[model samples]
Target: MTCDEAQILLHALLDNELDAGHAREVEAHIASCPACAAELAAQREMKRVLADTKLSYSAPAGLRARIEASMPQARPQPSRRSVLRGFAMGSAVSALAASGVVAVVLRQDDQQRILSEVVSAHLRSLQAGHLIDVVSTDQHTVKPWFNGKLDVAPPVIDLTAQGFTLVGGRLDYVDARAIGAVVYKRRQHIINLFVSQTASTEHRPPKTQTMQGFNCRRWGERGLNFWAVSDIGGDELTEFVDKFEAAMKVNVEG
Candidate 1:
């Protein structure tokens, strides 16, 4: 789930009012994301602070009922100040906590923040014309350049026969991990296939997501994650992903 959706449901989440599925997704995202987890921790602290306080207030039960019974059937709206003044200490604490949680959510959108960083790096590379640290169409040479630079060497393939030409390779950091960017070209469009090692509990079908105006298609294979991002059309990008996967499978099987 996105952070905005999580924020809207946070109060319900705190109250234990969210449905099971949504609660699970939000909790999983919160576990993966530190900023959101910190927000959760702050809210928990608020709850702790409120819970620890000794609040003593006993309203004469019948007195409020007796006053309401005597009032006319047609009620008048209370003044804004009166309403504000009428809130109890617990209500004030809740309001403050909700406001603080919303503020934190608005300030730190973890998912989009990471995506923006990835997209920015891509844009910056193109603008500065420094897309590749190692330049070679040959995957052997291009892949070996990563030695002593990064922990893992990303699989580099030449997709020229499939109309996606291998340009070269570059090193990039995205989603808090060091990754190898295998550059490809479709017509004049640039496709950056960022590869990194990430473990997943379950293997699922690849999915495409648009992030900050760039299309990113991500999938997992052989214990590594591949994220291909480009401004190229979705259909074409999907084709590229398909051929790339097929090529990898061939390389593995061969």
Candidate 2:
């Protein structure tokens, strides 16, 4: 395959989303083509860095309760009609109520979809044969790779001394913009740190939330918004964040 063709299919190839025939073709091309092989190697490294970074935070105790409370409640149906004519009308009303409930439920489900996607993407990255798209611990190398492909520069920080080693960074399309995902590793856990430059009004303080056993923490400061996710326990994740924040502060001050 041509270099351009290989480049176009590289992500899908790495994702193993291509059909057997296509996968074979791509593999053969990479075997003989130095350029394609280098591209594949870069993608593989990115996945490795992401897999090694272990970070996570716990959801506050009332998170689920709050979400449940905020959801709209279904109103009770009217009393059963005495006559056949009234009964038909009552049935229609009941149907409408049921539909309304379904709609509300779907809306709530949509609200949680983003969180689910974030976690699922991380998990998918960990699955066998899936990992980094570009692997490098150097911010200069990783950050430049995203130029022209994304609108903003994701701040890359190395936190190795603090126990969380910077594996690398990548550009991810999430919440409507190309955001930054800085990969880090803590022992056996892999942490994904997402960053974006949002408006001040859009900024939110660091808060932890959990979904499907994974932990997520988000906060905004100094013109950037950040989200960190992992399967690690709350205490350890929090400690990582504290250290990360301290590192950020030092960088900013310097």
Candidate 3:
């Protein structure tokens, strides 16, 4: 893995959020790369200092009791019929929870968290030298750069003809694992197309979400999840994804 790839994962490694495979890879890279080794040491020192510091403010005594006193008095106990009704409602809720309704809710929350992380990754890529590990416009060169680095490399399409120029690719972490990011340029704007393997082989349609002033279009195809994030307008971003997807289909069928 390149330093650029290892740099982003250092934090995940520190937090023990990375899977075993990724943790070993980052650790191995840090061992041989002096620059990355120093970086890891500095991060560890910073974390240690922060942990020793007292940053949280302690609430004053009686705060909860005072707030409770200001509120209206509690209502009387429910009648026997009302108590039974509440019991029935609670049972129904438990049944729904067992039937995966709660899992659906949790999945939505996880999705939002991933989207936030994707935008953060995009912003981090905007920093100098943090963008691409392999700097090249050739789709053939960029695609193979991720061969053994990632479990599955992202599709590298030369979309220069479609207005989004293929620039390079890199390894980035999302959802606690290393994933592939294919970089593209839409004029001055940068697009980071992140790809990761998914357990399910379901093909999901693209959904556009705006976060932190950037537009993100995410979808799933052929058991892989993809997120394309950029500052470009929504319509143009959609056009980019559409064209990119079409090209991917052609490649698969051809």
Which structure among the candidates has the greatest lDDT?
3
* Per-residue C-alpha lDDT of model 2 across residues 97-167, encoded as one tens digit per residue: 33333333344464355554455455445553345556887767777775544445666777787788877
Candidate 2 yields a Cα-based lDDT of 0.66
Candidate 1 Cα errors over 4 Å, as ranges:
1-111
Q: In candidate 2, which residue ranges exceed 4 Å CA deviation?
A: 1-111, 128-130, 201-203
Question: Between candidates 2 and 3, which one is better according to lDDT?
Answer: 3
Instruction: Please give the lDDT score for candidate 1.
Output: 0.71
lDDT digits (tens) for residues 132-240 of candidate 3: 9999999999998877676675788999999999999987756556678999999998999999888888889999987656789999999889999998999999999
TM-score list, all predictions:
0.55, 0.53, 0.57
CA-lDDT, candidates in order = 0.71, 0.66, 0.79
Candidate 3 has its poorest 10 consecutive residues by lDDT at 93-102
> 1 or 3: which has the higher lDDT?
3
Higher-lDDT candidate of 1 and 2: 1
User: Model 3, residue 69: what's the lDDT?
Assistant: 40
Better of 2 and 3 by TM-score: 3
